[model samples]
Target chain A: MSSLVESTVQETSHAPAASVQSASLPRLGMAAPAFEAVTTHGKIRLSDFHGTWLVLFSHPADFTPVCTTEFLAFAAIAPELRKRNVELLGLSIDSTSSHIAWVRNIKEKFGIDIPFPIIADSNKEVATLYGMLMPGESKTETSRCVFVIDPVGIVRAMIYYPLTTGRNTDEILRLLDALQTTDKHKVATPANWKPGDKVIVPPPATMEDVEARLNAGYECTDWYFCKKSV
Target chain B: MACISSQGELSESARKMLAAMDASATPEDVASRTELPLFRVRAGLREMAEAGLVELNEEAYSPTQLGRSLLTP
Candidate 1:
């Protein structure tokens, strides 16, 4: 699946940007753009995270109040993500040294060590690739963006926040759990769903399925809308 | 404590390394025992140490009391 998407990207990379629709923010279900970057922990590539889920997020800049709180929130949930085989990678248009210093300062001030690797995108190469930079907002800073990529490198979900707002860490974790649960059980999550809650059963595809589902022993609001304990 | 709840949060590789570790075992010993690559063993050890489940002393690695409790039940 990813190979097909990569070939498509390769074919388009040579074209002039003005000639084609500017490759805007990657859409959901597309293969995540590949990149090699210098991070606070070490040099890493997208493929380095193969076979694990990745939450790739971008912040505006370092040492800011909102970004600091978001980082702390992300750090607080690092262990929970680790339990689910998800790795967090942060990005900003900052240098590696600046990133190191900011992270050190955060550790010292907050007593919370950020366990994730933060990409130093001073040149904006990674930011450009991910379409994290919103020129209308601020040319020099990345917008608050989150891309959740699955184990196979396909982007599954994304969210963007304006510069003035901070992200909700709980929503991010809930989304991750919902995606994983859907993938594992082939069920859809209802509104305000959380782990251990009943899940929505896939709607019936045919009349035969509808008939079978009517007596399938599920908690059925209707044949088309059923809930199950998955 | 967070560490106690985090006992169930170790990655598969880290858990394997923890299971393979004994008193005075090195990262190399863990790699050999678990048949994991050396780099993976090292990474697992680092994560385990950070989680407060393992300790390193005099070039050897061993499970901390917290880590032992994780294995108990």
Candidate 2:
């Protein structure tokens, strides 16, 4: 397959939140806000990620059991993320010392070092900016939230979970793949779309498209469900 | 409702809420406008402990002078 077709294939199989939006969120496909902060790796600018896809995430705290599990999952997949030319950045309201200590503990106990920078947001600036600090969960900590930004800094996707539940790593990677595929191929992934499945062709938004779709030799249960090659 | 007779600066979220606050807006309205969870909106209001930032009458949430400052442009 051509590189374009390969990227489309990658997108259909990737994460859950890619291209999805919650009803209350700011519209997707728009520029994400710029932020700079002190992370585990040191001070970094949002612009530093100018040429790569970014998975910017927030967790409530360090050392908590639920957060630890989620962190490890992401850490284990760090190589895969890097392979895809995507960078992962974590955030929390804890101080830098706390983040460092927690990472060390995870390494010693779990035998893994998180490869990405964990933002030590001492003053909750990043949390508040990302709308991660939900007071219902904890006033001083961020909730579990994820943002997927494209190479140009447009926020293509975001997902938030209640404090009681952890997020899925596979779902996120799947989303990143899906989004990049859509951008590259101008196609859409079907619900529960996985790799090798037929993609949803953008249905006719205008009258002419309806006829074009009909003539496209696609499987049409309905005009809206026209399935075509990716 | 907490009435704002004075003025002060607003936080980003609060400023967003103030623009949407009409006489009928409640905590839900503020939450929707700021894209904050309901409890977060409550906490943000409470965090605004500046004397008039949040006025609670019965169960409704309204801004005070300092709170309005955050919302009013």
Candidate 3:
């Protein structure tokens, strides 16, 4: 995935424009904000993941039922994410003891060991900095948010949900596949894009390029909108 | 209406509210549907009413035409 991004057009400007949209949420093609936090593994900094893809996600708290279900889901998929060189980091406004206890509970009840470090954001400074605190939901807890950051510190994707729901880990993995595919091929993902689905060719930025793209044999609704069977 | 602005298109919250509307649910059931604070639920209900997505009668609530249209499973 990192290599794919490297081959794409050297678009540094796209990253900053994406940074604004992803200011409070995770935005793709933008740098992830740096942070240092205490985790189950020990103190770690966001910079530690300087050269690897990262999935930095948050949960409201430990021992809660919904969060328990979500962590289990993430745990189930951790190995698959690891195969893709994506490190997973979980966060919550809980103490270290609380996080450990929750991990123990998961192990005992679900018979699954959470393979990744769960950040114990006791003070929630990390949560606040990441805009995880949704006052409309609960001031004391964080919402379910996922940030995908590449090796170069650019945020590649973000997903957010209201506190009522758990995230779709399937969707996250699908998105990763899609983003990687697009970066490698200079294409895009269509609606409900899955791993093997046809890829979209990014619309050209100029009239001549648009005609050239049309002549390139991509499926186009109009000259301005073109998709490829990649 | 813009798809993004439509309440029906907001699958995240719409799913939660629909799950809460079950007759078997109690106040605790409602709370479990979404992790929202009590005030947020009240606010959402008010907003839904204004959007013609829900109606309140006899201290109970039910989806209106617009809401039902959005909840088509």
Candidate 4:
């Protein structure tokens, strides 16, 4: 698998300059692209997280102010995510040694140990596969992007932030909670929905179903809109 | 709501503030006790308050039941 990734990277590296534009980003509901790469923790493959939810994120570079804060924030909520069986994997186009040094620096400066594997995509194989590199923004550095994959490896959600902004850790955790709740209960979450808040039931499929929903003992705003406790 | 139930869930600065704070402790008192910067203490207090672990009242911050519970084993 590593050899395959290397060959692909070599082929792309030698491609015509005109054909070297950024690849299209992966679409939701599609299988996440697989890869094997060196990480701060050692070698890892996408299949290693086959049966657990994964939060795969990319930062522009290590040792930057915004990225450092984002890493700390992510590390802060990691335990909460683990309670839901989600694992986090971070990536950037930096070397593994650099990643190790940066993680150590973060621990020293902030007194927080990052408890996740960080991929060192120096060759940009994984980044290219995930469309993490936005050439329009910076040809070398990856943009702030996140991909939430389910246990089955389906891309469930994606978020992108500009190079200048830091991400909200609360929003990321809330999104994971929302996705898990919807998957488990077959209900949709309303805007700004939190864990204990009422969830929106899917709209009925037929007139009879709608009529049944009206008397379903839930709080109904109308025939098609209803809220129920999970 | 998934309350932050343990110190591990908090950032390092927040945990420091949590350790230093007693009932009705002010941010300044926490900063002095924890030896953390004042801005960091204020930020940690805000995050703790958002997590339902602390409550702020008239320039004073106090840990809630959830906060105390987190301190316990």
Candidate No. with top DockQ: 1
Reference-based lDDT, each prediction: 0.79, 0.71, 0.70, 0.79
Highest lDDT model number: 4
Off by over 4 Å in 4: A1-24, B1-73
Model 4: how far is A94 from its true place, Å?
Answer: 0.2
Provide the global lDDT of candidate 3 against the true structure: 0.70
User: Can you tell me the CAPRI class of model 4?
Assistant: incorrect
Candidate 3 at residue A216, lDDT? 80
Query: What does the interface RMSD come to for each candidate?
Result: 9.3, 16.4, 18.6, 16.5
Any residue pairs clashing in model 3, and if so which?
A28-A156, A30-A155, A164-B34, A164-B35
Model 2's chain B yields a TM-score of 0.60
Residue-by-residue lDDT tens digits, candidate 4, B1-73: 1123244465555567787887889877997899753434654576578778899999899999988777766
Per-residue lDDT of candidate 1, residues A140-181 (tens digit): 999999999887777789999988999999999999999999
If both were scored by lDDT, which would come out higher, candidate 1 or candidate 3? 1
Model 1 chain B worst lDDT run, 10 consecutive residues: B1-10
CAPRI band for model 2: incorrect
lDDT of 2 by residue, B1-73 (tens): 1122236445455566556665536666776776653433544454454456666777566666655555534
Worst 10 residues of 4 chain A by lDDT: A13-22
Error of 3 at A134 (Å): 0.5
The deviation in Å at residue A84 for candidate 1 is 0.5
Q: Is candidate 1 or candidate 3 better by DockQ?
A: 1
